[model samples]
Target: MTKLQSGMSRRYFLQVTGSGLVTATALGGSALQARAEPYDTFTWISPRGTLEVLDDYPYWSALKMGYFGDLKTEMQPGPSDGTATVKFVDVGQADMGFPSPGVFSFAIENGMNLKSVFHMGARDTFSIAFRKGEGTRDLKQLEGKTILLGSAAWQSIVDPMLAAQGVDITKVNYVEAGWPTWATALAAGQGDAALSWEGLRAEWIANGLEFEYWLGVQHSTLPANTFVVRSADLEDPDRKAFLEKYLRGWAMGLEFGYLNPRAAVEAVYEQFPTFASNTGPELGTTSILQQINVFRGDMENREGWGWHDMSSWQAFFDQIHAIGQITKPVKAEDVCTNELIAAANDFDHEKVKADAEAYQLSEEFAAIDVENIQAHMFDNAV
Candidate 1:
């Protein structure tokens, strides 16, 4: 066996990247701290290279709404290698990460020792996009057709989603057409379909790259992306307390958005001005609502936000295993836990709703006919 050379940790690499945005103050405690002192900063690394997307509105909403309180936070855009989110969290480069269940499974199978504490995307967000009126409605028709992807690492995400629909994933061709341009590649008639998702459906339309989509929320029953962290870190009381506070911020943020979505969009716009100028108020708000619909699934029947259904996750793992994506029998409990759900949701709902409704909106954002937007939200849903 060959021994690997020792290198700098992912944390050090993140510091050197000069891309981290420090947004808050420290709650005090390092990953290895033995005492009860509060940690300085809690860094969250995104799976993608940019945080300007609408997919993470809850975090930004929390930031703008002062939900995180005194807990200092940093948001880092991890490399687009796909596995870097969980890998960074596992190596202590970041305190938390947002990763799909498929990526989380891969980490568990490879002994990464991470746990998904927050089930953010309660429903499937993955979708297959096709050129308008130029593609078949049937997923089985996708067999043997070329599918464009932003990265080869996304194959792990695409394979299970395709297999769930009775498509022969082995026969489906995936081409890495590069990020922020794969849909352009598809529009250029280079592929039959491209991997797309919910929030992106609206953002793409805003960018004028419209496409018809077979949305996973309407098609599949699998669990979507979730917030994960190193399993070993949870054993520390101080760290766990910090986590509870951090997640509470997200829960409150979700509640805020669910109450008044336009405010959430405004929060994202306030956080990233450039992103606002590009997507604009109409589609940007639409994108925020699109993701919220995925994040809030049957709230009347569920316990609360970030709650995980063990059976659904088990079924997901079973399906991926049947598709040969996972080599071993991986149990749901081994990779995720609902332990933090209650603490994360320990907040006043009515108060959050009050805050959301009272939030002042810009004339442009307030002018959006939200009822009309919701009515047409599913126009391209297959």
Candidate 2:
């Protein structure tokens, strides 16, 4: 088996990796000591294509900032969807993966003993996007309308969202299509509405389309994405302690992103020049800021960052169970654990938040409001 070599830079984390990834020394079990552990190698797989994008700001930032301590992290960009990510983690092809709850649940039923350690996007980003003036305003509006879907897994979200609005699923027509252009199609009256994740919000602006969308979080009790590994890993005290330190740095990167979104975007653009896309800084920074809002959702109020009560995951499991995706009631307790994340937040969060909040931006950056996350979410969204 190939191992991730040392001296690997953060910018190229996703580019190269041998067969095997990481093996680190352990730390104390109970107390979260602010000590870094050294690891020969480890593999981390990204759910998305590259770290240059907005959602992955934390990972890229952490790498550049040396958050992994001495771990030789071999990062790989995942293929197509979370399914590949789940499989990679299941078979040991990857040491860890960031998978959605749906994918994570599926793996559990398939006999993969996985556990979630981090919650990346607490609020659900999945939605049905429509134009501002004529686009869909609510989930109830989807009745008798043609909606474009991304994949079969989306039904887990589509069915429940419609049901929550008291709309019958049979009344809606679902058509599968590729994204980034669905907004244009909806604008041209090709469909009544289109399914969207917040990530696609940038594409809407890229195409100069006015849009507002519905969030799955507002309508359901489910989270968006999380970092996961084998359930067995938690059995090892050293491994678990190492995760806590890693999360500490990861959280720092996320907070830093909020403090200086423009700098974060610029850093990624400078590193992965191909991701620049020539969209210019104003729009890119705005997109990155929009994503930052989602990352901070209810984190302060919840059981710290990445921590969640089982009740929060119930509705999602119930919805998927009805659609035959989950055969029986998948107990949230059996599927996920907040032990590591709870420890990850043991550090002084107030300092991180204050630092980010205090970061002053240049006029060019200040002029662009990060709060205007949805150009179409509200008439006065900004």
Candidate 3:
């Protein structure tokens, strides 16, 4: 679950007016094809910074596993913004891109020829965290309290989530503060709660901090980031071949990562050597793993990998439409196709599960320890 900022048309709210915002096919088609051949190359763009975060893990892991076969991945670095990703695919500069599903709907309504091919992760990483033992039992309890956000940009996201819960947003005070200093502000009692990531949940629990929290996804069964491509790519000169192979590799990497988290980090570091960081290697590993953990909050309960329920998508888009975020009609069937995912789900799930369960880290990766970065990660666990 990560924030995907699709370039929504900016509307000035001068207190006088308002504004608005906004899979998978695989999946496993290699079955009947004779010695499959993957497509030539796929130019893909990521929603976040280039190959640096956990959100890009499966793609990196796939590269590590050589699942791509003949298909070469040409990565175009994103501006680290979701809207940019939507733009990349819209203009055909890239064949595929990743962006938050919430913002993605706007792209479709605005007449972008994109369709989400797979449920990268159906839930967002966003959560509201406040001081533990603050007597806040549920999210609705913050009726008249303050919720802190990094910027006014958060309103499009947090407001819908709040309104969905039936908590009158006007009744609750919203404080704008710099994310760098939001933690201090929260500690100083300047805000009752702050928006955060699910990765912080485990850290707070491990440290015995009773930070009361509610995940936006838990309250709103919304779609998060997705693996998307142009509708033309699905039809003429169809790219489903590449899509299916790409997903298999992706799914494989994810299973391997689960079995060997440290190795997964090392794979990305090794494959994307350009991603040098001032942060230590261990911190990078921990951060990537934590972000990977975000998916499990909802994935573990799903029927299979990359499963996207129509009802969930409807609930989210319905809410968005109800809130006047989108007025143009965009049918889900036109934008998403499950044929590929159904094919992928048909893969040997039982075997994949067993392999992952029995997986052991290589010597190089086994040396990593969570404690190495725990001290630095407690407050900001990406």
Name the candidate that leads on lDDT.
Answer: 1
- Per-residue lDDT of candidate 1, residues 131-179 (tens digit): 9896555899998799999887788888888888888988999899988
- The whole-model lDDT of each prediction reads 0.81, 0.63, 0.59
Candidate 2 lDDT by residue in tens digits, 229-343: 7665677687677777777777777766766676667556656766666555676776675576667777668776667656767777777677567677787777778777766
Q: What is the C-alpha RMSD of each candidate to the true structure, in Å?
A: 5.7, 8.3, 9.9
The full ranking of all candidates by TM-score, starting with the best, is: 1, 2, 3
* Best of the two (2, 3) by TM-score: 2
Q: Residue 282, candidate 1: how far off, in angstroms?
A: 0.8
Query: Of the pair 2 and 3, which is ahead by lDDT?
Result: 2
In candidate 1 the C-alpha lDDT for residue 146 amounts to 96
Q: How far out, in Å, is residue 147 in model 1? A: 0.8
The ten-residue window of minimal lDDT in model 3 covers 23-32
Provide the TM-score for each candidate, comma-separated: 0.90, 0.77, 0.69
Residue 165 local lDDT, model 3: 76
> Candidate 3 — which residues are off by over 4 angstroms?
1-40, 131-137, 141-154, 170-193, 199-212, 217-220, 271-303, 328-331, 345-382
Best first by lDDT, ranked: 1, 2, 3
**Candidate 1 least-lDDT 10 residues:** 24-33
Distance from true position, residue 257, model 2, in Å? 2.1
lDDT of 3 at 204: 37
Q: Write the per-residue lDDT of candidate 3 for residues 93-207, one digit (tens) a residue.
A: 4567776665577566565667887776656666778776673436678888888765544555666676677777667787777633555577678888886655444433433
